[model samples]
Structures are given as C-alpha cells and as structure tokens.
Target: MLQDTIKAQLKGYLANLAHPVVLEASLDDSAPSREMHELLHEVAALSDKVQVSEQGVATRRPSFVIRRADATGQGMAGVTFAAIPMGHEFTSFVLALLQVAGHAPKFSDDVIAQIRALPGKYAFETYVALSCQNCPDVVQALNAMSVLNPNIHNTTIDGALFQDEVAARNIMSVPQVYLNGEPFETGRADVEQILAKLDADAPRRAAERLKDIAPFDMLIIGGGPAGASAAIYAARKGLRTGIVVERFGGQVMDTDGIENFISVKETDGPKLSAALEAHVRQYDVDVISSQRASELFPAAQPGGLHGVALESGAILHARTVILATGAHWRHLGVPGEEEYRNRGVAYCPHCDGPFYKGKRVAVAGGGNSGVEAAIDLAGIVAHVTLLQRGSHLKADKVLQDKLYSMPNVTVLTEALTTRIEGNGKNVTGLTYRGGDGADHHLDLEGVFVQIGLLPNTGWLKGTVRLTDFGEIVVNDHGATSIPGIFAAGDATTTPYKQIVIAIGDGAKAALSAFDYLIRVPATGEKHAAVLETAAK
Candidate 1:
C-alpha cells in the first residue's frame, strides 16, 4: 500500500487526467490478489477521474488494465501490469495511467506518428523485476505504444511474481520481451530500438530525417558523463552544439550504485544520467538519441566540418567533434560465453542477480567489479565461486575483507575462465585454468562476467590516433592526435575512469576546442600544427 505522503503525491499527479480512467481487475483468492485489490482501492479514492472495477476479467490474476472510461477495445488496447508496480516501476505505472487517460506522452511527434502507424498486431509481454533500474523505460515505452496504437498490446509482468512463467521460458534477465509468444529482445530498449525491430523502413526513415541537418559548431559523439558535460559547456559558450549517441547515458546507464560522485552523497546511474540530461536540455543542444556513430571523418580543412557517420547510414557534420563515446563491459571471449548469454550468462549482477536466488553461480575476474558482484550475489545466491586470473584479488582491502567475511562465497586466485559450459539451453557450469595450467570445471547455474570494460573506439580506427588497446590518445587539454577533434572519458587515454573524472575531462576538452576554434585561421590546413604546438 502507498504511504500517506506517496498517496498525496499520487493524488496530485492524478489530477492531471483529462479523461476518466478505469482500473479493471481480475482477482483470485491469493495474497497478491488481496494486495492488488487494496492498492486499487486506495488509488481509486485519490482521484475523482479514476475508479476501480472488478467487473471485467483480465487474462492474468492479481492484475489490472488501465483504460479510458469512454474508450472501447477497438480504440485502444489497455495496458496491463500483472503485479504491484512498486520500486523502480512505480513511475511506470503512474505514467501509464496518465497516458491512457488522454494525457499525451512526452515523445517527439515523429516517434508518436511511427507508433500510431505501426503495421501489424503485436502482443508484447515484458518480464521485469521491480528492482531493475532499466525495466521502467521498456515497460513505459511499450505501454505508451499500446496507448498510441490499438494494434499494439503491452503486458508488463513482474518476474518475481510470475516465477512459473519465467522458469518455463528460461528467462533469466530483466526486461526480457516477448512478441506474439516468441522471444523478441532482452535488456533495455527505447522506442526507436523497438520500432527498428518491428518496422522494416524505420531505419531508413530515421536516417532520412538527419540527411538535411545543418552543421554544428561542436558535435559530441556520445552521451555519457563526458559527452553531456561537453555539450553543456559548448552550448553555454554560445557555440552551436549537438550530440549523436545511441542513448544519453551509454555505460553509465548500466551502472548501479554511484556513491563516489563528489558533492552528491549517494545516487544511482539512471538518476544521475537523468540529472545530466536535464541540465543539457536547458541549453540549445541538439540531442539525436537511439543512433550510434559508426565512422568518424576528420575535417578536410581548418574551420571545415567533420563528418560523423551513423549506423543508420546517416552522416552528420560538425565544426569541432568531441569523442566521448564511452566504454562497455568486456566479455570473457571464452567458448560458450555468447552462446549462453542471457541463458544463464550475464554481465550485470545488480539486474540479474535475483533470478539466481538459491542457485550456484560463478563470478569471473578478481578486480573490484568481480569482488563486488560476488559480495552481492552471496546474499541471494546459494554459493558463489570467484575466479581471478591474477595471483591475488585487486579490489580494495575493505571490499576484500567484506567478500571474505561471506561464508557462501569462495575466491580462487590465478583462475582464468576458459569456457562456459551449457546444455544447449542453460548454463551448467564453467571451465577455468588454475595456477597449475590445468583446466577445471566449476558447476553453477549462472556466470557473471565482471572482468573489465573496453572503450567504444572500434569505429575510430584509421580515422584518428588510437593506442594499441583502441583508446583515443589525448594530452592534458583533451586534444587528440588530430586537430579540431578532441576525446575524453573511458574512450580516451585518461586514467582512472570515474564519473567525476569523465565530467572534468569533458569540460577540459570543450575549453580546448574553444581555444582552437578562436585561434585557428580559416585556411585549408595547419590545424594539426596548432595542436602539435599546444602539446609542446
């Protein structure tokens, strides 16, 4: 049940309903059903525009459908939530109610139009955990689509509440989506990504929209802490700034706890990302999300535009480019790793750890990430085997001590993952090499890879100077080897990749770029010489 303060807030939010809304519930004699009934009763009391009805039966018990009072099935397929939408999903539930009650969703016109014109019928059921930070976006998006188009129907199911269905489908990850009873996608997916999967022309249409964009004074390729900071600084300097990234957060979106950010006592990744994005939007920066940059073409001349190609086949031009395309979790590259991915192999311990409750699992790597994952899993999983390639754990002494205190966790030094063993459907165990150089198998239900991260610099090959490990090399001012092109964050040679460091690096790169822009002549060349002299 919602608290008094939360109920007051919910009542305030429900006042925005333009039309009367009904919560049609189907209940059974179960604890969850009783809880659901109580929640619905409390919610209906808070708003005159909202009421609960047990008249119409739903497909699932302890579930309800949000529908407009005047709308029929032909107009809109109601959005369903099969369990208590608390934790990270509370916002999703509230948003769905507002969107279904004639309030327009906060999305671009083009995106909304695409959803309304979606061709075929889609019955989507997304399995999510209430604790998952990334699940609400998917649930809310699908729910919005259902409100937009009658042909699309969305059911957001809490995996913990529907354990039987999750086990039957072998769904071991949060936000596991199914379309028309078939596996569709797993992990976080935005509106654009979902549309790309459903519509054949979505990509082409999206690319065409960017074909006529005007060149910007500063273009940032990434939307992590680095890219966001750079965009804000550039925009504040009166420079025409833009951002081209698949998502605003990149790797930061996948992060869980972020207590190290200075000035902020404690925060999570999504919250921090939202704050940064809100700050950026206060300026005149153009953010092109759900689009990944695939190629980088340097400027042909000083003050000339640099061409940045996207995976969607669209190319955007900018006067100065800031490379902040962050990094991603590095896979073990061992056999069966990819094959069993999401089938008992996962990288995010926070998101997928609960699915392995009372089960055995293995944590790969010896660094902070691996040790932290092991410590977390120790509370949920039955047993955890920590594997480290080095002779000793590289985590801090405090973390090491905490990990060792757990009786359910075991650490193995000089252990290198060789292969992830599975029975074609789910992971059965894993093979690793000990200090004796002999491979040994550890039986487990899941394998959590926390080895490290690799920079998102693969697309920059042959375009700019990169280290052997594929990181863009930069000086103190964040200037890369190429002129008019700066880099920052985990994608660059900057050491100690942290959120605060990335933000500082982004500001430095923006200032350096401004300095270059003001001093460089509009000649056809000599841009590289300016960078060389500045480095000296």
Candidate 2:
C-alpha cells in the first residue's frame, strides 16, 4: 500500500519507538482487510520494535489498534484505526504508533494534564475522508488524548470506505466526531476546544492560568500567515512576542491547494500551517491556542500596554498589538440554509462533495472557489449548476475557461440565491432570481456556498478605525488608528487578501510597531492626538 520511499521514511520514524508496539488488527474476509493486512505486515518488517498480531480486542472489523505491548484493557481504551489512514491521515497514524510506543505527543503540558484528568469514560469515533485537510487535527487530537488517558478511546472511521455507516448515521461531512455513540461535533476542533467541551470548568481554569502570563512587548491576536510572520520578525528584534489565537491556522486550515506562495511550487493548507507553526516555534514566541479575543482595549497612555480580553474571561496586556485575525468563509444567509446545513447546504466542496455522488448539485458564486468546486463536481455528480451573483465570473481567466469547458456544468450570470429548498431531512433544490428578472429554481441534491470571506474584525469595532464592511482601517505601514495598534491580512484594509501579501504585510506591521515603540515616550499620554492623526 505504501511506496518504497514512504516505507523507508516510516522505517526511520519508527526507529524512535522506545518500546515494543503491537498492531492489533480485527479484520474480515474483504479486499480492504486483505490490503490492510499486507500493509501492517510490511510496516512490522520495517521496524524491529513493531509487530503485528490478530485476535486482539476489537468491536469493528477491518480495524486495528496501536497499543503498548503490555497494555491490559478493553477494545475501547486506546487508538483504533477503522480507516486505511493513508493520504492526509497517514501522519496521524504514524504519530499514533510512536505515541503508543512511549514517544511524546506535541501538546502543551496544560493540555496533557487536562487529558489525563478527564473524568469518566469517553469512546470517541471520528469519521473522516483521506482527502480531508481538516481531519488530521481532530483525529490526532483524539488519538493523543486516548493515549494519555486510559479511560478515553478513539476510533477513526473512513466515511468513504464505510458508506453503509455514513448513510445510516446521515454523516455528510468530514471530521464528524461522535462521543459514546452520539454526535459530539460535526467540524474541526483543536485540543483545547475538545477539552473545553468535555470539561465544563475548563474555561474557568484556563482563564486563571492565562492571568499569570506577563505582558509581552508584542502580542499577535491571530495565528495565520500574518500573525506567524509578525511573531517571527518581532522575536528576531529581541522583543517579547506572544500569539493568542482561537486556532493556530485560522481559515488557512480549511484551504487545500497553494501554488502561488512564491517559492514553494505546491503545498496544501495543513502542510503550510505546520511549516508556519514550526517556523514560529524556532523563536521565543509564546504561542497560545484556542483562546478567542472577545474585546480589544487600547493603550491607556502613549507607549502603555494594550489590553485584550479573551472569550475565556482572561485579559492579556501587551505593549503593542497586531490584529491579524484573518477571515472565514462567507455563508449564503438564505432561508433553510442553516436548517439543512449537513443535510444539503454545505460550504466545503472537498469535504461534503462525496456525499452527493451521481446527484445534481449547485455551486453558488462565480469566483475561484465556486468555479473550482463546479469543475470538481462535474466528474462525480450528474450535473453542476453554477450561479453567479454578478454579470460575469470574477474568477481568474484560467479557472473560468476550464469551468466553461466542462460538459456537465451550466453557468448562470446575475443569479441571486433566495432560499435553500429542503425536505426536512435533506436538501432538494435551490431558488434564485435569474438575470431576466424572473424567479428560477434548480432541482439539485446539494448546494455549495462559496462567495468570499468575511473579515474577523468584529471584536475590534469601536476600539480601532474600521471600514463600513468591518475591515480594520490601516495606513501603508500597517498601523491602525491607535499608535501602538496595527492590523494585517484579511482583517485589515489591504486590497488583496492573498497569503503572500499577508506575509509581507505582517512583516511591515511588525516593523512599524517596533518603530513606534522606540519613538514614543513611556509616559507620553497622547492617545487622543494619535487617534486624530490616524483618522487622516
């Protein structure tokens, strides 16, 4: 199943195993099981510390559990892989093997404590697809949690391979997690978010823990390209840099392909996010994850520290703050959209497109995301109808040309989606206004809403100068209205919201902040004048 180069790489990685590890497989007389059997034996051959065995505890056939050789427990006490765990999940599988063999997982001490202290028993089943970029985080998080705590058990299921279970449970999205046989979450969740869900007092504990942190010379409010870049530059300047974010990758985690990142020819979102985080770790930046900023308080006096209040009820102070909160996918706020979210109205075509195989679907928008989704769906679905709110497609010429060349695609310009039609259980069609000033509807099984992104600067309102569309207004130097405050990436007034632009803008914001720090006096209380000058 694995390539020769991949096998050699796995051999090198598995050599880190501190103790003997057993691959306990419960397989059946099926082709996938036969393939899995061959794969496990091949892996066991690579590493002396690894071995394969059958007749181990298992509740699901065609599945395996990575466990310590001396473990004594039930089937629901360790990391189980019900899927092939190839593609995006391969890293997670390798990590599970190492972690089970006494290799430490990459998690904070506080999170590790939370996982070990989790009360009661938890049986987590995460359904994922191999192509899903967002599944690895959830799968790896659960696997790590299970390895840390004997009471927690996690099983990763491949939704595509197990089509019967996906349909029986009505699972339509990737990274769908179920706890103790009931649905827990239907989307991507980091380690902190999952801990917060299981432990009711987690937020209060986190708030208390955050209060002890000393004020940073530069604090970044996001963890995307902008925030990562800013952290690197500020740390290089010998400034005390810290990053407080809800998630490390932001919307970049949801992205798939990135061919326009300057140097690297091609890379995916998760891979790029890992590189960004790894790069940031090389510096002295204190990276905090899964804590959202609820409010922004400007510096009281010139060169004074700015206060950022988090949703966890903790307030952090910093001498300079960078608002690189980034953006999220804009939704079509039409009727029945939310009601049938998992049933039909979906946002990520890569995640939910497989559920509508051989069925007609509609892609709402005329931009790159919509056109790309339409082109992708043309191969799997019977037909794809792309609706553009504008007179013409706003996508790049190459994408538009490819979309127009598809045989199973129909494009409608100047079309506005009015409502998402659903039959309570599943999506049926979509209603839209045609270019001819008439109401039109298309019969389809699913709708993919991919208009654009909405900047995540809602919390900065009243604290910083903002455009009417909620983007933080900034100067060419990336400084916001307040002297010590700055913004970048999709949340700022930058014309382009590309990753490369965000990276360069982040460096600019960091330099601007460092310059402001040296220029302003510590006791200079000129907040009002700076605001006035920034307004110009």
Candidate 3:
C-alpha cells in the first residue's frame, strides 16, 4: 500500500508535469507483480496527467514502460522500470517522465555539444538499488543526457530484481553504469566523466599532452575533503594551485553519512563530496581528474621544484605538494564478501548502519574500529554480533567496557569468518567457526568488516618517510620529513581520522606550504610570475 502523504505529494508533482506521460505496466499473476500493479493503479488514480494500462505479455518481470503521453494516454520509445521504483530512484523515475514529455534537460552548452558529437548509437545500462541514496544522481544524469542526444539511450535496471545480472556482472555497488556490453564506471559519476568515457580517444589525448602542462605553486594530491580544502585555501591565497585525483572526492565518495563536519548536523557522503567539489570549482584550482599519481620526485636541491608523474603520462611540477590521499577499509577476504559488498555487507557503520535498522548484523574483527562499529550499530539495529578471530580483543579497555555494557551486543572470540552467504540479491547470512572448531551459522541482514584501514600510501613508499603501517609521518605543523611537501588527512600520521580532523589537517598543511614558499627561493621566475599574478 502507498503512504497517503507520499501519494498526495506525487499527485501534485504529476499534475504539474508539463508533458503527457503514460505508465504501461506489465505484470504476471505473481504476488509481487500484482502488488506492483495495484500500486501503480492507485498512483494513476491520483492525477489526470498519469494513466496506467495493463499489458498481457511482460517483457521483463513486473515491469513498467514509461513513455510520452498522447491525447489518448498512449506512449512509445519510453524507459523501462523492471521493478518497483522506490527509495532514491523514485525521483529519477519522476524526472524521466518529465524528460520524455519534451521538457528541456538542464545541461550546459559544452555538455550538450559533447553529447551531440557522440557517434553512432550507445546504450547506457545503469544498475541501481532502491536504498542507495546516491543512485539518483547517476541515473538522472544519464537520463538527462539521453534526452539531449538522439544517439544515446538509457535503461535503468533495479539490481534487487535482477539479482542474476547483478551477480553475473559483479556489481557490488549501486549506480554501476555499463556502456554498451562492457562495464563502465561505478558509483556516482559526474556528467563530464560520462562524456569522457564516451569519448574513447580522451585518455590518449590527455596522456599525450601531460608534459606540456605548466607548473603550479601548490600541487595537492587526492581530492578528498583534505585535498579539496587544501586546494581552496591555496587558491584563495592567490597561488597557482592544482589538484590531481584518480577521481574527485577521494574516499568521501565511497562513504555515506557525514555528521561531524562542524555546523552541519546531517549530510550524506555524496552530498558532502558534491559540496566539496562545488566549493573547489568556485576557486582557481586546476582540477586534473581521472588520473593517478604514479611517481613522486622530491626536489634534488633546496627550493627546487618537486615533480609528480601521473599514470596518464602527464607530469606536473609544483614548488609545494600536499598529500591528502585517504585510506580504505580492509576487507575480510572471505567468500562472497566482495560479491555482497553494499548488498548484505558493508564497511562503514556510520554510512550504511541506518539502512539495517531493526535488523541483525555482524561486525568482523575486534579492533577499535570493530568494537566502535558494533557499539554504533547496537543503537540502531535489533542486535549486533561482534566477531574476533584473535584470542583477545584489540580495542581499548574503555571501548571494550562500552561494548560489553550494550545488551544488544554479542561478542564472539577466536572466531573465523569462513564465508558470507547471500541470496543472489541480498545477504542472507554467514558461516563462521567457533574456537572449538565447530561451525556456526548466523542469519543476519548485514556484515560490517571493520578489521582496520589501509592508508593509500603505496605510491609514496620511497618518496616519503612512512610509518611501518604506510601512514606518512608528519609534525605539529603538518610538515613531512621532506621540505616543500606536506601531508594531511587520513593519509598522514594523524591519530584521529574524523572529517573535522582531516579538514584541520588540510588547513595546517596549506598554511605550512605557504610559509615554506615565502622562505624558499626556487629556480626560474615561473614561481615569481605566479605570485605576481596572484598579487594583481
């Protein structure tokens, strides 16, 4: 049954829809199909702009063919909804109807020209999950692109309904886009990224021109909050700054909820990432996207330029460098773990814990992160099972005390997670072994692997003095062992890994770099010219 308030709201939205739209629902006699049909029928009854019709033959299971409406409420050349479009995708579905009705898409002239120039027919198969909050961004972006270009067609498939396809394609996360038959980008890819992917020669062209780039005053590595903040701060100081990122937003893009960013009480990862990007865009920071730094060459002499070679064969030289590359959660390498990632398995409890409210979940490992995640999940979920393979928990005494005090928390020691079991679409449960070598099975909604974090510093092994754990060693002023190069955020030796901490780290690094630039005399007038330009 549809919520009355939601139905009312949708009715208003449908009434204001400029172009006519029809819902061609095709369902079998199955319970799920019948339920979906009734839901659509109820929705159609709300507004004259929306009309529903039943089809005898179903092209896909419990599918709805949304199309442009004629005077008689008939449509053709429409988008298909293979499952009940709920969660974040509901808005995308509404927007798609509007797009089909001849509403002009809001794309810049540059993006429009790129889409128009795309050769031949290309199909964008976007896979989404109803619960994924960021799925709509990619789906809507593709939908808008489809409307602007005649050669491009977009189809959205609900990953939950097409579990077989999800498993076959190894789509661990939502908003996974497939261009033609090959796998394209994952997660929320911007329209520019999509266009770049569409253009096959873009990488080669970018690679060929890498050496022709100008040097910058500050070259910030990574595009996470720290890097973004550093870039903005450096740019505001009138320094010619540039940021190189494999993808913008860094690890923030993979995250979900961002609560403790100061002043902001609530915000999702994608939203916060978008804000960070938008803020950087307002500055004069040169954003080099979709490129990874392969090598870092420190200055041979004092006040000399430090050069970083990118994977794209482009080398960027800067007087100062800031390392804000973040870390990623370490996975438990168990069977089905990778397949069910973001399905019935998750890493960040802060990000995905709310999705499993009132459901049973497990936290692997007994480290500080594991115990903390278990404590956090116990508040929202019905129960939290903490699994530790070691003989003793590695978390602090205070954290262990808090975890023990929680009634909903269950602690299992000397346990090994043998496998993660899931139904093709969602995680059903998991198999583990107890201390006595006895097998145990738990019917859980989700599993959170919180073994630990691995800092993204493999590429900086030789260039920087790193701790044994690969975190860059830094001082109180965010200065690394090497001069003219500073480290910040999760990539540094900062004890705390919070967003606010990372932001402060970024500010510190940028300020330290500015101080170094003022003291050091580098070779050539390029740096002087940049400073002069900034002064003007």
Q: How high is the CA lDDT of each candidate model?
A: 0.89, 0.88, 0.80
Superposed Cα deviation of residue 441, candidate 3 (Å):
8.5
Cα miss at 80, model 3 (Å)?
4.2
- Estimate, for each residue in 286-391, the C-alpha lDDT of model 1 and write its tens digit: 9898999887778777677677878887878777899999998999998999999999999988889989999999999888899999999999999999999999
Worst 10 residues of 2 by lDDT: 525-534
Query: Which of the two, 1 or 3, has more TM-score?
Result: 1
Q: How many angstroms is residue 136 displaced in model 1 relative to the true structure, after the best TM-score fit?
A: 1.0
Question: Which pairs of residues collide in model 1?
Answer: none
lDDT of 3 by residue, 148-257 (tens): 76566677887767778876875555677888888787766767677777787766666665656788899999999899889999999999999987666677776556
Give me the runs in candidate 3 sitting further than 4 Å from their true place. 1-58, 61-80, 83-85, 90-114, 161-199, 208-211, 333-362, 367-385, 390-410, 416-448, 525-536
Identify the candidate with maximal lDDT.
Answer: 1
Per-model TM against the reference: 0.95, 0.96, 0.74
Tens-digit lDDT track for model 2 on 22-136?
8989988889888889989999999888889987556677899888887776632389999888888999999999998988788888889889998899999999988788889
Going through the candidates in order, what is the number of backbone clashes in each?
0, 0, 0
* Whole-structure CA lDDT of model 2: 0.88
Instruction: Work out how many backbone clashes candidate 1 has.
Output: 0
